[model samples]
Target chain A: MRYFNNPEALLRLVSSMQEGFAITLTIFFATLLFSIPLGMVIALLRMNRHRAVSVPVSLYILVMRGTPLMLQIFAIYFAVPMLTGHNLERMTATILAFSLNYAAYFAEIFRGGIMSIPVGQYEACRVLGMRRSQTFFYVVLPQVFKRVLLPVSNEVITLVKDTSLANVIAVGELFRAAKNEASRTASIEPLFVAGLFYLIMNGLVTLFFNRLTQRMSYYRD
Target chain B: MLEATHIRKSFGDTRVLKDVSLRVSRGEVVAIIGRSGSGKSTLLRCLNDLETVDGGEIRIGGQALVTMQAGQPVYKKDGERRALMLKMGMVFQSYHLFPHCSVLRNLTMPQKLVLGRGDGEAEAKARDLLAKVGLSDKAGAYPCQLSGGQCQRVAIARALCMDPDILCFDEPTSALDPQLTQEVLGVIRRLAQEKRTMIVVTHEMRFARDVADRVIYMEDGVVVQDGPAQEVLGDHRSDAIRAFAGE
Candidate 1:
């Protein structure tokens, strides 16, 4: 409330979000960069008929999806070293946890996209002499990405907010920065101001997703 | 030329094609006609090795589809199946154009990848094909934007990109509106004029009557009637074909 007492204090609150915003973007961009390919790999693994591939992949998906992201952050931040008997940094643990957690979700999305395509497309590729890799890259994946973008963009927008959760493990991200500023200055107004910050980032991501939808609109059946 | 002997396929316990034998000589356009679920499509797939046969063999351009003469697997090595599929192009009932690529890109990909034709050369050829199919104005459009007939013509143009000797059609006009059906029929007639060897499976009796060199009527996965189009559709012989023609 004291921060809201003056224009300069509010200005301080706005400026304070910069550090948290950067951390937010870090988690946002990093999750997209890492999760897409990893999700595709996991998707392919789940598609595999062999128990060696499917069982473990399904297990990963089960554990990640069955639990909340909050629990996962806690586990990776705490349980990893206990099990592996190794020391780890907090930021690294957050990223590892978030990437894997989202990957399981994105894998199901990718599989749905792949499965949604008509079977004749595969036959078309096969009879056209496209090799497996070529068929996938040229024919299958363009479609998977097209089908997946909306759901993925929704997740990405969600990721922007989810990065705030990293503050639980002391990542010094946007939310953490705001919390630090608020505690130091003895003001709760920074928290409300921080919510406004998340909205802006989410708004920009929504526009980006609109553009993606425009590009993919052609691929719709 | 292509030949198949005792081609058999079954999904689980339900056998689709039982001891199916077919032979196609050079420059022959054989039309296979049948009711729904009569295995007309499966036979075409078997001819092209799109579906693996449980017990039989298909040879296209002197290459076996299921197994080699050595009795090992066919396409045992990488690129073997690709090498064979390149010689023949198949047109599906639903025009399976790559949704992401434009019509120009659709026509160019197979040329560049399968025929090793460069992009510029393929584009020029694609333009010519688009012109040939009366879709020159639609070259910039994607498959989804086109009508079903226009898409089929584009599919034909895309298939022609490879300069294949054999073209296979699976219910080419079944999905089109009546006015659109004539557009595709015109293209098929033109292909006949160009002496393009083709195998078309269709329910359009009039198309089989007008375009086929020889019409083979399939009933219960077997050819019940095989003769010149005039004889086959112009007062056909077998009771099965008679009933199939709704006589």
Candidate 2:
């Protein structure tokens, strides 16, 4: 509480937390940039008729979803390098782990969205003389995105909090910086400040998704 | 012209179309009427290549869609099938009007993507067709925004924008109430007066009798009777057709 009365200490905490927040933002944005499209590809692979492709994808999804994300971070940061004889930088390991893990969740969400579309859409595209790829990209994906937007927004909001898990690998992101600040200053105020940052980031994400949903409201199911 | 000869199809153990053959010449409006599960819709689907025939042949404008070779049906190649489909258009019972797009886009997208028309040209043609269908005001609306009647009209205009040689409709009015049915059937009646070539599978006896030059009565997966509309619908000889026509 005394830390709140000290202007210099509060300014120091905000400035240091700002640097950590930048890394946190980078992780959040990079994970989304990589995972979303990769999730769509994995969803398509999961939907493939061939057992050889679908079976392995199913297993990958199972492992990713069933295991703890923190454990996955450790395995990627430590075990992967030991097993492969190639070391990944701490931030690289964190991003690789977060992206692949979230992609599994996004893939299932996408599959559900794609499957929810009525069969009539595909028939309409086919009768219109559109090839399969054209139908999927133009006719199907737009509708799928509309239907999946809410669920995807939920996953994306979860991703904001999940970025904190990167701290388990000692990457010195937001939460780790906050923890270090608290220990150094012998005060819990920095932890509360870190929670506020998460709340603000998630609030912005919610507002962004709400705007997207409104723009897409022109067409209903 | 469209010719479907000995078209046979089945779903698992149940046969939907059995040796069904039909011939429709240019500028003819043919209506196939029957009880549900009589394969009327399935025949229309086969013509559009929505369902591959288990055995038989279909030729559109003298181009073979499918032919029998070595005891199996050989369908046209992908490019050939696409080209053949370009010459035909279909409207479904559900209206299937790409619900995510505006009414104008539903008509214009296919023209731009399939026919390679420029965007302005496609939009101009779409506007014209929308006006013809009495929906020029609803061009900015989505299919979900329109009533069942209005959606069907948009669907019709969407199909016609392709400038196809033939148009197919599968129970277009089956999903509509009486007033909405009239709204759709009125559009069909006008198209018929314009001498457009169309093949429609309908449950509306009156629309079939009025708009079609040829009326085909189907029963148990085969064409039981086919003749001029006046002769067949007015002076039908089959018991099934009489019961269905409510005579």
Candidate 3:
């Protein structure tokens, strides 16, 4: 209560947590950067005709989605080093685990989007003599993006909170900093401040996605 | 300009097209009319390589798109088939306009991507075809903003932008309201007047009678009658065709 009453202490608390906030943001952005494109490739592979290719991709998605993300982080951090005899940095393992888990989710979302397009769209491209690559990248992908936007926004917001899971592996992320400060000060004020930080971050994400949705507003089914 | 012989297609146990054959000369407007599941659309699709024929031969503009070999249909090599397929353009019943693209981009992008036309050439051709379809003002508009009839006209214009040697319409106006159907039929009438080679699969008896030079009627996947449009529709000899023509 004394620390909560002191404005100077609150200011210090916020400043001290800035590094953890930065690490959280880094993990969030880096995960999106790597996972989104990886998800698209995985979606394509999952939709492949060959069972050998699609079945393995399906199993990968199943494992990632079925398991807890915290366990995944632990496996990457502890088990990988034990098996490979080379230790991964805590940050690297956290990012890798988040990316792989998120990519499975995004792949399923993208596959649904791709499949939602009518067969007529592809037939139109075919009769127009469009090459397969041109048809997919130009005609199909834009439509898929339009269809998948809302679900993707939901997943992205979930990812924001999921980033806090990184503290399990002691990655020094935002939640970890708040927890440490709360134990030392014996007050919950720092944790409240961390919640504010998360709200601000997700607020920006929501704003960005809203703009994207508006830009595609002209497209209608 | 287009020929198919013994064209047979099957979907699992059901035979959709059984030994269907057609021959269309240059600049001739041939209309194929049949009931649903009569294989009219499937035959048009086969001519355009949208669907592979199970057994038969399809030749467009003296280029063989597919030929029968070992009791199965063999398509030309990829590049050769694509080149041959480009000789024809198709307007679908649903319009099938790329919903994300502007009306102009729907016409222009395919030209630029498939034909490697420069921006200036593509835009000029797109504008010309849009004007031809009486939709010059809608170039910047998206497909969703247009009425069903207007979308179909844009689809016709998109096909014409390619300067195809032959054009195909798969029931172009069947999806439209009766009022909207006439506007699209008017566009097709104009194209026929221009002497463009076109093969149409349609349900409109009057449009087929007035616009088509030749009418081919099908039933249960076989051509029931093939003759001049007046003779086929006005044929007193075949009761089935007379009933189909609403005589």
Candidate 4:
């Protein structure tokens, strides 16, 4: 209470964080909304038996997952567009880096879930005369979703916290705002406030996923 | 009618099926039994092309199934696979009731996807099937929320929704508790009474003897005994079958 002499100061502080919070949320949610699907596709590609299809996909996944996410982020943010000359903006580059990073991780989770399903399910689907695609989508995908939820949720939570890392590329997410506030006001108090903000956002995300789990509890496989 | 001339399959040098073959009429109920690793399940799966037979020719209703082809040989197994699949319903050892969908949706998915039934018609058919299985009250429940028996009943309702001519059960009662098995077995027995064509691979000799019209006994993938359930179960002549039933 003593740290804040007036409500106006608290209001300004919250408002300052809001601009970055929006960026943080955008990076987090957009990465998830896109990456989960992309990751699943990437995972499927890796699992493909044909070397022409699976080899390159497996190499791509290995490169992304094998390296530290931070290093990949820096490489993609700094070097990716230069080779192709896409000239992406800071926020866009940050999002792209985050998306690719999480996609690799989510791909593994998807693969694990797909692999964990009893082979009998596929046999059962094929026995019923389902096409390969139909069997994968109808019989196989539902089970994978049920199994991969927890691992994917963990990656998502990690992504939310990882948004802070985007500040390196001047994306101006939560931690960036805190840094600005700390230096401008010459107070470490604003830094603690931003830390609290991270906890709140992570907590909210955890709650959302918990609710999702309940809705899907009906499907064991 | 179904005719499998010479069905064969092997797994990594460990042969599971060996030149096995049989025939079933349009309304026949064939029960397959064997000791573990005798390829009883493999034979059933091969008949449906679930397992690619290494060497064989299968004909369903006069169609050749070695390639899932069209016309000639009525291989209800090849290009005929999809429609044949629609015409055939399957029950798994672990009741695969499409856990993602509700009971009604589970029943309708095949009708809509495979049978090309309209949503309205599929819904009606699903409801009817659910009623037939005595699960109309649980139509909204997902597989997880239901007991093993209820889930299996839903699985049956789902298969029946497609109006398949042949219903295959792969050890349907193997995974269930004794009480739950009775419920599932009762549904299957009722289907048999309605003159439904069924091919079942099971270890339950009692059910096979009680419900099956014809019984086929296999050893190392070849049929060693084929006759009426009573003859095979009671009049077991082969030492292998006698040994199997401990007679």
Candidate 5:
């Protein structure tokens, strides 16, 4: 409560945390940008008829989902360096680990969405003389995106919080900064401020997704 | 013109089409009628390359779609097959309109993507086809927002937008009620008046009798009767056709 007595100190705490918050935003955006499209490709590969192709994709998903994110972060940041003899920057390792892990979950979500689409859509596309790629990209992807929006949003919101796990490898994101500030000032107020930042970010994300779902409500199966 | 000769198709050990053959001249409307699982739909599907024939030759506009190669029916390459398929259009029993797209887009996208039409041209053609099908007012609406009849009309317009040389309908009104079926059959009748080449696989014998110049009856995967609509439906000699006509 005494921390509120000094508005200047609070302002300084917020301003200092800006750099850490920027890193968190970077990880969040980069993970989403890479994971979503990568997830689509992974889903297509997983759906392949040849067992040779799908088996490897299945194994990848199993391993990524079965392991803990914290361990994956450590493995990417530390174990990768030990194995390859090239040290990955902490931020790079964090983004890579998060993208790969999240892509697996998103891939399954996409697969379910894509499969749920009635087979009639594909037959219609074929009879229209649309190419296989056209059928997927034009006729199929939009519906799949609409169908998987809720689940994808769930992963995205979780990702906003998951970015904090990057601190295991010393990536200076928002939570790490808040923890440092709280200890240095010997007060828990900075932690509360950090929580406020997360809530606001997630609030915006939810609003955007809700708007998207509404826009797509014009069509139903 | 469309020609499918001696077509043979089987699903596993169960043969669906056995030595089915038919030909349609330009601007001809042929109706295929049969019982369920009698291969009426299967035969129409083969003409559009929706289902491959185990043995047969399918030629569209004098272009070979499928040819006999070493005792098997070999389809043309993908590019060639696509070009051939473009010459013919199909409307399905379920309509199968892209549910996520507006009625206008259902007609326009295929034109733009497959036919390489410009946006303005595609839209213009789509609007014209919509008007033809009497669904111009529903252009901006999604298929899911339309009734079964409206969806089928939109589907017909979608196929017409491609400017195909032939059109195929796989039970275009099988899913519609009596009133809705009338709306859809009206559109087909209009197309028939315009001399659009169409092959409809239908169970509506009355509509088939009225709209189709030729009627082909199928039973157990073979053509049991093929003749003028009046001769086949009105005075059919086949017992299966009599039974199917509910005589």
Candidate 6:
């Protein structure tokens, strides 16, 4: 209470946590950057009619989705280092784990979106003499993005909170910084401020996705 | 303009088309009519390469799209096949327009992408076809914003924008109510009067009798009757054909 009550002290505390907040944002953006496209590729491969291509992708998705994300983080950070006789940087390990886990979930969502498009759409493109690539990029993918926006928005919100899980491995993200400050000052004020940070970040995320959804509402499947 | 001979297709163990054959000269309108499981649609699909015939030869616009090689059907190389297929356009039972695109864009995008037409040319042709289908005012509307009949008309205009030599409709009015069906049939009727080559797979008995120069009736995966429309639908036909005609 005494620490938070002092304006200078509160300012110092917030400034100190800024580095950790940036790290959290970095994790969030990096995970999404790698995961979204990777998920699309995986989803396409999963839909392949041949077993040789699809079987391994389905198993990979199963393992990634069936296991706990924290355990995945631990394995990538600790177990990989031990098995390879080399250490991964904490941030690299954390981002890698987060990207891989989120990609599995995104893959499933994309699969549903792609599958929901009717066969007639493909036939229409086919008889029009459009190439397969043209059919996918122009005719199919835009509709897919519209259909999967709600589920994708849900996953994005979950990702904002999931960034805090980095603290389990001492990655010193915003939540970890606030945890350290709370202990140092023997006050819960820092923890509440951390909660505020997460809320504000998630609020911005919600706003961005809501605007996207609104822009696309003009078209319907 | 189109010739298919000895077309045979099967799904697993069930034969959907067994030795079906048809030929259409330029400026011909052929209506393929039959009961639900009689493979009428399958034969039309085979012509358009929507369904590959297990064994057959298909020639469109005097170019071979597929030929019987040994015991199986072998399609032409991809580039050649696509160019040949571009001479034909297909409209589905359900209007499968790109819902995200306006009616004008739906008609123009394929021309730009597939034919490499300039935007000016594509848009000009799109507007012309839209007017032809009585949809000039609805150019900016999305498919979902239009009624069933309006959407079907837009689909016809979209297919026409490509300047296909033979237009194929797979039960174009099966998904429409009678009123909506007439609006679509009216567009087809106008196209027929202009002497556009077309093949329609439909259940509309009167439309087939009136509009189709030749009617090919299918039953149990084989051509049961094939002749001039009036001759087949008029007197001197089998009881099966009479019963199918509902008289």
Q: Chain B TM-score of all predictions, in order? A: 0.94, 0.97, 0.97, 0.92, 0.97, 0.98
The residue pairs found clashing in candidate 6 are: none
lDDT per residue, candidate 1, B115-207, as tens digits?
788878999999999999999998888888899999999998888888777999999999999999999989988998888889999998888
Q: Ten-residue segment with the worst summed lDDT in candidate 3 chain B?
A: B233-242
Clashes by residue pair, model 1: A20-A174
Candidate 4 lDDT tens digits, B26-63: 87899999998999988877776677777778777665
Model 5, TM vs. native:
0.94
Winner by TM-score between candidate 5 and candidate 3: 3
Which candidate leads the pack in TM-score? 3
Query: Per-residue CA lDDT of candidate 3, range B105-201, in tens?
Result: 9999999999999999999999998998899999999999999999999999999988899999999998999999999999999999999999999
Please state the interface RMSD for every predicted structure, separated by commas: 1.4, 0.9, 0.6, 2.2, 0.8, 0.6
lDDT of each: 0.84, 0.92, 0.93, 0.81, 0.92, 0.93
Off by over 4 Å in 6: A1-11, A82-86, B235-238
TM-score of candidate 6 against the unseen true structure = 0.96
Instruction: Kindly report the docking quality category of candidate 6.
Output: high
TM-score of 3: 0.98
Task: In angstroms, give how far residue B44 of model 1 lies from its true place.
Answer: 0.3
Q: Write the per-residue lDDT of candidate 2 for residues B1-247, one digit (tens) a residue.
A: 9998999999999999999999999999999989999999989998998898999998999999999999799998999889988888999999888888899889999888888999999999999999999999999988888999999999999999888899999999989999999999999999999999999999988788888999999999988899998877776456777787677
* lDDT score for candidate 4 against the true structure: 0.81
The true-versus-predicted C-alpha distance at residue B123 of model 2, in Å, is 1.5
lDDT of 1 at A49: 86
For model 1, what is the C-alpha lDDT against the true structure? Answer: 0.84
List model 1 lDDT by residue over A112-144, tens digit each: 999998897888777777777888888898888
**Residues A104-124, candidate 2, lDDT per residue (tens digit)?**
999999999999989999999
Candidate 3 steric clashes = 0
Instruction: Write the residue-wise lDDT of candidate 5 on A1-221 in tens digits.
Output: 74668899889999999999999999999999999989999999999999999999999999999999999999999999899999999999999999999999999999999999899899999988899999999999999989999999999999999999998888999999999999988999989999999999999999999999999898887
Backbone clash pairs for candidate 5 read none
